[model samples]
Target: MGNEDFKQDKLIPIAQRSFASYEEMYRIVDFLNKTLKEKYNIMFGLTKNNKDGSMVITIYEF
Candidate 1:
């Protein structure tokens, strides 16, 4: 590693949140999983929960 190769740029990290209602969340999750399953034939789903009042969703495969 050379010192010249280490260049620091101004790239600020941002936290992204999906602020969707219960119905919208369900639709998005279902559509994504179904489309992916039918098209790519990958079996998976989106799991969601509330942690500290923040909604978090994760993709998992069985």
Candidate 2:
């Protein structure tokens, strides 16, 4: 639909975690995303904190 129909509240962060390496964090996020995206309408995100080298995982409700 349109941007007006988009609800910011629906896209919320439900959980978060920090990891030492991207590979390990990515694996878990990727698996959860693949398994939960359709049935649960949930998604996972990965990013690096600018101040630190650790990888960050954010679980979201879609």
Per-candidate Cα lDDT values, in order, are 0.45, 0.78
How many steric overlaps are in each model, in order? 0, 0
Best by TM-score: 2
Report lDDT (Cα) of residue 52, candidate 1: 41
RMSD to the true structure for each prediction, in A, is 12.4, 3.4
Instruction: Show the lowest summed lDDT stretch of 10 residues, model 2.
Output: 1-10
lDDT string for model 1 (1-62, tens) is 55322321222223234444364566776777668744543332333445544344554332
- Each candidate structure's TM-score, on Cα atoms with residue i matched to residue i, is 0.39, 0.67
Deviating ranges (above 4 Å) for candidate 1: 1-23, 41-51
Q: What global local distance difference test value does model 1 have?
A: 0.45
Write one digit per residue (lDDT tens) for candidate 2, span 1-62. Answer: 65424633477899998877665777887898889877887788899877878888888886
- Clash pairs, candidate 1, are none
